[model samples]
Target: MYPHPHALEAVAVLRVAELLREAERERRLPRTSLRRRLAYWLRAWAEKLEAPNSQLGYA
Candidate 1:
């Protein structure tokens, strides 16, 4: 089965967040751009997933 665009985007955002958190833990400066981009992607993904009377499942 083909994956949805929003699902792919959500995965990308989660990966970025994991990288940023690791960088922060290592005392390295986390890139602001990455954080901002993650936020935007997550917001868009959430909007797509959250629909009236619809149940969404994530893998």
Candidate 2:
């Protein structure tokens, strides 16, 4: 069977988040900025979506 659509979306989001982290590690992102804050929240949301017990109500 194919993977769930939501699962695929979550993986894509998580990959983008990982790239943001790599940019930060390379001193590309600002230490205290809106972009960094948004990235942080995006990563958190992706993690929640990727959780086994996600509350998104997917069957």
Best by TM-score: 2
Q: What is the C-alpha RMSD of each candidate to the true structure, in Å?
A: 4.8, 3.4
Lowest summed-lDDT stretch of 10 residues in model 2?
50-59
Whole-model alpha-carbon lDDT for candidate 1 = 0.62
How many steric clashes between backbone atoms does each model show?
A: 0, 0
**Candidate 1 residue-wise lDDT, 1-59, digit = tens:** 99876677666656765665666679686558976687567656555555454344454
- Candidate 1 regions with alpha-carbon error over 4 angstroms: 30-56
Candidate number with greatest lDDT: 2
Q: Report, for every candidate in turn, its global Cα lDDT versus the true structure.
A: 0.62, 0.78
For model 2, residues 1-59, the per-residue Cα lDDT tens digits are: 99777767777777888888898899987777888787989888777876778886332
lDDT of 2 at 18: 89
